[model samples]
Target: MPRKRTPDAHDRILDAAGGLFDRYGVHAVGMQQIIDDLGCGKQLLYREFASKDKLVVAYLERCTQDWDRTFARALAAAATPEEQLVEVVRAVQTMVPGTRGCSLRNTHAEFPDPEHPAHQVSLEHFKAVREQLRELARRTSAADPDRLGDRIMLIIDGVYASGATLGATGTAEEAVALARDVIRIETSLPVAESEIPADVR
Candidate 1:
């Protein structure tokens, strides 16, 4: 009879892989590293994940779920589109750390072939994120939807390229300030048409 596998093998492998990928990127990590970190035999790891590509897809999916929850919660905090936009920026503000870069962007740069299993999964995750930003742009009254959407995407790319080494947390804050300015410049505060309604005085 085959020996029973450790119950925590799945999570431990993912945790080890996530730390390695987030810190050094997926390509930099190897099966040896995973096996060493997991302290498990090769067969056990294979039984759980099958392949590195499949495991990578799982990790990216976890990131996506986490981000979606954050965005949804922030959006739910406000009643108006403009307010929701600010909250969205605030949501992004919380995502930065000192070492690891954005997981999705890192994967995109590391995976050379678009058809690579992990690469395809990352692409889908990216599309979903971009679509979310576009929807945020539509909700934000201060900037034109398409243009602001493009600019936000650009800023995000810049943030990833900046990396922790360049102090990207400051970049996130600066981006928020810039976004507020963009909104202010494009949108005027709603004003009464120089006369009060008789019913409201």
Candidate 2:
């Protein structure tokens, strides 16, 4: 009789795949690379994920779950919409210091085809974050919530794009300040220095 496989095998495959995918890329990292990294055979990897595309989707889904948890924690202490907006930026700032770049953005860049499952997952995640920004913008009474949301999203993209090149040079910190300034200007509020979170300030 065949030995029963542990559920942890699935997580181990994803963990190995996530590291490779983040370091290299979705298309560049193959199943064999993951198999080697995990010291597992092709059959075991295939048992957890039917195909490479499915593994890519799982990797992205894990990333989204992590982002959700981080965002939720960031918003927990925020008392107002503006504060929440700033917290979102702060959350990204906190997350960027040790990372190479955004995994979702990296995956989208590697696989540009819209029909790809990984690409579709990346798009949905982007849309969801943008909508969250729009909601926060509306709550802040911005003249144009959509425009504010777009601008904030642009800042986010800039942070991720420049992080690989300028992260250690304080690029992420500067981006957070820029985001705070944009929010203040759009909302027409004189945001005090003390109002800014210590980490972001």
Candidate 3:
């Protein structure tokens, strides 16, 4: 009889691959590296993921799940939809430090072919996230929620890119302030004094 496989085998492989991909990027890492890092036999890795492309697709899906978690936390952290938008930017700002930026964005850059699975998955994620933001924006009193959503989306994209390159020194530090200002200006609501930075106030 064949032996039973461990329940966590797939996740273990994905976790290892995700770490490597996040650090060095998908193109730079290979199957052997993942195997070595995972300390699993070649057959086990292959059994779990038939090929590198499949593994990459799995990794990108996990990254999308991570974004979902960030969105949930941001959604739960604020009392108003307007504040939730800023919270999304704040959450991303806190997440991007000491990393290689957004994994999907990096993977999308590596696989420029629109036909590539990685590119397609990342593109879908972007579209879904944009729509989700627009939905949230519509809940606010902003005259043009779609424009507000796009501005917030741009802020998040900027935060991830800036955080990866500049750590705390770049526009990452300004993301929350800019987001708050954007919300205030777009919604015609004044920011609470407590929300302002001490130095700025």
Candidate 4:
């Protein structure tokens, strides 16, 4: 009879696989590598995940959850829609350093076939993120909320791409400042009292 799988076996395997996938792109890593990293029997790993594709799907789903958390944190960190949009960029900027960029993005590139589950999941995530940003942008005073949302999304994409390629010192370092400027310009927001000349005040 096959040995019973532990309650945490699936999570254990997933966690190990996620770590490896994060370090190296999904395609570069393999089941054997995950088994070695997890120190679990091959049978056990297979029992938990039918195949590598399944494992990758699970990993990407977990990554989507992580993005949700990031979005939640950004919303909680700020009061206004403009601040929240900037906070989203700040959140991504905070996360991209010293890593292999966004996991969903890397995995998306690895699986180019649109029919592939990984690719589909990545596309869904991108759509969800875009909608969330648009929702926030609509709440702001921007003349064009959709445009503002797309602009912020571009900044986020740049942050991840630059951070992964050039590290923290590259264009990634300017992300927050650029986001602030974009928000200010898009919203046509008034200057802060501190920025106003004392004589004028």
Candidate 5:
């Protein structure tokens, strides 16, 4: 029987898998590719990951941690909820062009089984992002935060799609502009001042 790989070996495998998953996408890359990329044996890969699906889950989990920390930290520095929203949108500008893909979106794009742990995580992340945005929108505007959050999410989805398709055509700039417009519209909306939620920003 193949010896169990050490924790270091597992970490290395995950590191390699994440890079490959990000660069080549989850569906596009395979175990052999990971093995070759990691320069680790097949036994080592299996010992660490158990199966491809398991590794996929690990990859996504890692991404979630990375994103959670990044967004949380970004939101921390902003003085207001509205400022936080603009900064977050501006932050994503760095990801536009090139592959222009979202890690969670790329992972779940071809997923047929929503029951998969990776798929579930994707759904949860999506919901979390939407809620966060909704709260931010509510804090930034006078109207219903839920409605603006939904609209912002719709535009965010479009921005992701546009980023993937726009290549080097200044899509990042365009996404920022669109997001700013959403914020502006939100500020102009009429609602009781008391309706706006406290900043979780």
Candidate 6:
């Protein structure tokens, strides 16, 4: 009889795939690369994930979960809706340093076909994040929450885009300040400079 597989086999495969996917790209990393990275046989990987496409989908799903958790943790200390909106920027700023770029954006870029499962996962993740931003904008009494959310999303996209080339640290700092300014303006709050770093002021 065949021996039983380890309970963590699936998770281990995901872990290896996630690292490779993030570092290189979904399309760039192959099943053999993952197997080599994990020092496991192809059979074990195939047992956990039936195909490369399925593995990519699983990797993206895990990334989405991680992003949600990180954003939630970053927003936990925010006391107001405006602050919560700003926290979204802060969350990205905090997380971008460790990442090469936005994983969702990268996935979307790599898999431009809308019908692709990985692309769909990326789209859903983006929509969910935007909805979260819109909810916060609504709570903040913005004149137009959807518009405000869209604007903030644009700023975020710019930040991520720049982060891939122009150094994440500076870009992230500027992006957070810009986001805070937008939130304040939309809410008719005073143009407070408290959140702006002294160097950037």
Top candidate, metric lDDT: 3
Clash number for each model? 0, 0, 0, 0, 0, 0
Instruction: For model 2, name the residue pairs that clash.
Output: none
TM-score for each prediction? 0.81, 0.88, 0.91, 0.89, 0.81, 0.89
Residue range with the least summed lDDT across 10 consecutive positions in model 1: 187-196
Q: What RMSD, rounded to one decimal, does every model reach?
A: 6.4, 4.0, 2.5, 2.8, 6.9, 3.0
Off by over 4 Å in 1: 1-7, 189-201
Which pairs clash in the backbone of model 3?
A: none
Model 3 lDDT per residue over 40-143, tens place: 99999988888999999999998899899999999999999998998888888655625788888888999999999999999999999999999999999999
For model 5, the stretches where C-alpha displacement exceeds 4 angstroms are: 1-7, 95-100, 189-201
Tens-place lDDT digits, model 4, residues 1-201 = 966767699999989998888898888998999999999999999998889998899889988898899899999999999999878888886666247888899899999999999999999999999999998999999999998999999999998888887775466548877888888999998778885789999
Cα misplacement distance, residue 32 of candidate 6 (Å): 0.5
Better of 1 and 3 by TM-score: 3
Which TM-score value belongs to model 1?
A: 0.81
Off by over 4 Å in 3: 1-6, 168-172, 195-201
TM-score of 6: 0.89
| lDDT (tens digit, per residue) of candidate 1 on 1-201 | 866656587878888888888878888999889899878888988887788888888788877787889789878998976656656665665665436667877787788797887788788887887888777778666546767666666666665556455766676777666655555555664534443467776
Give the alpha carbon lDDT tens digit for every residue of 17-115 in model 2.
Answer: 998888877778888989999999899998888899999999999888988887798678699887787777767755552366888888888888999
lDDT of 6 at 19: 84
Candidate with the greatest TM-score versus the true structure: 3
Model 6, 76-116: lDDT tens per residue? 86898788777777677554533568877888889999999
The lDDT-based order of candidates, best leading, equals: 3, 4, 2, 6, 5, 1
Pick out the ten consecutive residues of candidate 2 with the lowest summed lDDT: 91-100
